[model samples]
Target: MSNFVFVLDTNKQPLDPIHPGQARRLLSSKKAAVYRRYPFTIILKHLSLEPNSTPSQIKIDPGAKVTGLALLQGDKVIWGAELTHRGFAIRDALLTRGSFRRGRRSRKTRYRQARFLNRTRPQGWLPPSLLSRVENILTWVKRLIKFCPVSSIVSELVRFNTQLMQDPTRQKEGYQQGTLYQYEVREYVLEKWGRKCAYCGVKNVPLEVEHIHPRSRGGSNRPSNLTLACVPCNQAKGNQDIRDFLSSKPDLLKRILSQAKRPLADAAAVNSTRYALLNALKKLGLPVTTGTGGQTKYNRAVQGVSKTHWHDAALVGETPQLQFLTNNPLLITAKGHGVRQRVITDKYGLPKQHRGRFKLSHGFKTGDIVKASIPKGKYAGHYDGLRIAIRTKPSFALYPKNGGKQFDTHCKYLNTIHKADGFAFSFVGGDSSSA
Candidate 1:
């Protein structure tokens, strides 16, 4: 057009009315310009303060929130920090040091300051609450009606609870906080459940936690977040809400939500997820002949089904293996692991703990080495090891620690030269080997 110079599209979303995407510059420097002022700024949380910064740093604090500004920059981060005030030499150094020391607690201070100092702006095209409702409606409608109503090719619908992400800590694990809807659902269940198992009245057994809101429909994992479920009840309940879990019953979702308790409503939510499995031996679905109740080897049957059922597993005859960053960070999820654990062995222990799923956050080349530490136990000291590829199914691959596989249960889990600290390992070289 005219003589306007162009460089790159800097995301200029405002931090407040004074500034949008220019938070770093506006907050740090006065000369920086902001187009808007007095805006309703969202307080973003860092999903993970300690993210996959570098291939060397795998398995960060896991507790650190990743919903901060300086996020998704990958691991090569200096830190999500800024230098506020400085006198000259002495004052500057002190300010820098203080920034590093505040830790997670400082995030609260940032929130207080932002809320008090920043001006709230009026909604333009969309209000956050309305937008969130739209998202919920779309999600439910898609499930009930199928397909999102009115869509753009570039529009990407993220998970629910996007607003909670402003806080950096919860950001890392995907803004996974319990919501008001979830709380309402839980309260409804407890009210209906008379404080004990409906069928057995046994209160001591570790209760199974479930959601009236199906996990597939953006449900989250939390306490007011869940309902009491016994193994026997759960097996019968499956994935469907309570009514669907039982036949000839009406859908309870609405009554459950409105009745304010999970159990009492005639059509309220209950469990009805189907656990379907067929033995290769019987067309009528003959149960296995191996385990206590004639079930196939636990791991073999559920190897790829920790997240889902065997019929829904990725592979037909084989198990799906955990993907790694080449030989870097191991993919891990915080739920239902037994379904996957049975794959390593055929033993079927009682389903006791919460499910743990495998998750691979990032990938690395063969040459990229990751620095990891022993999570717990005797191997408290850190060491180093080479990475060797552990090939499972041709389609699935994972790289176990090279040199010696110490993390293995078969005694190799220990190191020869034990240091007071835990062990370290790398992808390629760069101090990736134990001397």
Candidate 2:
């Protein structure tokens, strides 16, 4: 199976997506023409389409990091993408800017009026780091709607509960007590060790309930002494005290003991912005349905499908089964518009150089998808969404879509395929032709 081919009528009105084979036939028979490259959309040349179309649903698996998206018609998944966010990049950029500003102000400059508490955030204001996530998702959804008749949306609002998973007995014993009785020993141990082997830090492996103190040496089975460790680590540390075993790695031992006393702190920060995402989705005016990580996991398990973002997305919503899904879905990285207009600065917060005001050069800009055919040159081949830097006159520095070595290419040899849509494209699981 492959991604659903986006369809459009002669008037450019949205229509239900068709199979790749059907799209191929239409292209071969000259009934349709390729409209977009990344999503593989086609527009009808002459055929009149009805206003009514099949109801298509967009499923989203929102996460603190990578987000999963899928477009489904009936039980068939037509399009899927794993949207990688640059929230951390945005945060780092802001931090660098702040550091530079602070450094500049501290160096023999007249004191300015304090701006603290003067600037007020408007209602529903979100930090740029968080807002970037919401905007990225919205951008894709809007683009999809322009090509396909999307009727509804389903999104995963929250991940599975850590406490419930760590201690299953809590379901019956209530919040205060569980099977172990003393402060939910298993849950504490799992959280304290971060559900991974304490020594190796290997996760997703079967972890054995371990004792920091050797039981044979009078180590109690209390929650304070319990920790999670992989089978290999447990065997290696058999009958040995934790401090003695980790004597060579003093820092690791200190970190483990220090973290054990504190609860997980990052979860709250990750989840705080999700409600704002949900609200943004609702503004699209579609009937939005929400699910939890537990439900998504259950659905995926029942379907016997391998774990992937697309599979998780297909399993979302009220759909009973997924009749078809692409063996290789497109992997899209949301590289925001290459429009940084700041002057380059040195390490000491001094301006090193000024950037050019003009964005266009030789009738093309960076992030533009282009095809180049140079008969005799080092940079000779087809390229898509290659980021370019116009340093010289005829030749420009070209960076490959996928991370690799960059080279210079002539402007005359390059043909613009698509204007940059504020995204960088790459294929995952298989070749681009499979999509």
Q: Count of backbone clashes for each model?
A: 84, 1
Query: On residues 230-286, what C-alpha lDDT tens digit does candidate 2 reach at each position?
Result: 999999999988889999999999987776656543344346666787888899999
Return the lDDT, model 2, position 338.
61
Decoy 2 TM-score against native: 0.82
**Winning candidate number (TM-score):** 2
Evaluated with lDDT, which candidate comes out highest?
2
Q: 228-319, model 1: which lDDT tens digit per residue?
A: 66778766766665546534534344433443333342111111100111111122222212111001122224443221211111111112
RMSD of each: 26.0, 5.2
Cα-lDDT of candidate 1: 0.28
lDDT values of the candidates? 0.28, 0.74
What TM-score, over all chains together, does every model reach? 0.17, 0.82
Clashing pairs in 2: 4-78
Residue 162 lDDT (model 2): 35
Off by over 4 Å in 1: 1-194, 198-202, 216-218, 222-225, 247-435
